[model samples]
Target: MPNDTILVVDDSPTEQRVVVSALQAKGYRVITAADGDEAIEKAGREQPRLIVLDVVMPKKNGYQVCRQLKSAPETQHIKVLMLTTKNQDADKFWGMKQGADAYLTKPFASDELITNVTRLY
Candidate 1:
């Protein structure tokens, strides 16, 4: 739904733009953060329903952010989808262990992104 906001966290400008554009085109209220710390701040401040998180980032990483968010009562309700280039099975397992709702690798299709986001809604 357009009413639900999504926070996209990635250090890469191009990747951030691509994801933001795709989500905006799909009618979601999209917000963005360039790294993990910013992601955590925006997630707390904006209270977005979902967060599209990147694994490798400065200040902090997706796993750290997800773990912190899940542990905090204020942010524990937010859903996190790990969107990163880390495609290893261990990466997915660790992400899920940290409370990620979904794990999608890089080079994902726009439709797949939309579908996963919609499922979260």
Candidate 2:
């Protein structure tokens, strides 16, 4: 998808930079949010094509944000990729239940992220 934007939602500055740089390098516009609340606001205001979300955050967590977004008619069309350190099978299942299109564990390669995102779009 040409001109598609991606929202990288993570509290860790390093993780945010990693995802932003990786996606930008692949010619996608990248937006950053420090936590789930910000992510929700940006998801509405920026209307990015995809959201790369982290599970652990100070307020509203990724799962809660994803659920909120999925439930909202205005944001439901946006795809969500859950990227987090929580790699348990149950976590993946819950993420899916919360409406994540894809689930990825931490330490995942940049290429893998790009590949999964590209495949999703």
Candidate 3:
């Protein structure tokens, strides 16, 4: 499972660092994108096992990226975990509607993120 690549997508450099570092510390091969467009491109090219996506981003939001990935036959099998600062119930429901496999809010514990990523495999 550690061999599986995970794409970490966020516009915030700080959030990206935190999640990427956490995942790398767990020995997972992690890649990152600064925005949703890059996220979608990387998801298609890299064929990552999972994508850790942020809700708000430039070019495209997580919901849009998630919807596109889920809709595409080649990418639909990849697990999507919506990790964002949006903690509202409606936001979570929307993420689910977009086909997120799991939804995690910001300020999440490293262990929790690792646990969620591991569970996906």
Error of 2 at 27 (Å): 0.8
Off by over 4 Å in 3: 1-3
Clash list (residue pairs), candidate 2: none
- The local distance difference test score of each candidate is 0.93, 0.92, 0.93
**Candidate 3: tens digits of C-alpha lDDT, residues 2-117:** 23899999999999999999999988898999998999999989999999999999999999999999999889999999999999999999999999999999889999999899
- Put down candidate 1 lDDT per residue, 1-121, tens digits, no spaces: 1238999999999999999999999888899999889998888888999999999999999999999999988899999999999999999999999999999999999999999999996
Which ranges in model 1 have alpha carbons more than 4 Å from their true place? 1-3
Residues 1-121 of candidate 2 have per-residue lDDT tens digits of: 2237888999999999989988889888888999989999999988889999999999999999999999998899999999999999999999999999999999999989989999887
| lDDT ranking, best first | 3, 1, 2
Residue 41 in candidate 3 has what lDDT?
Answer: 91
Q: Give me the overall lDDT of model 1.
A: 0.93
Q: List the residue pairs that clash in candidate 3.
A: none
Q: Give all TM-scores, in the order shown.
A: 0.96, 0.96, 0.96
lDDT of 2 at 51: 93
Model 3: what TM-score? 0.96
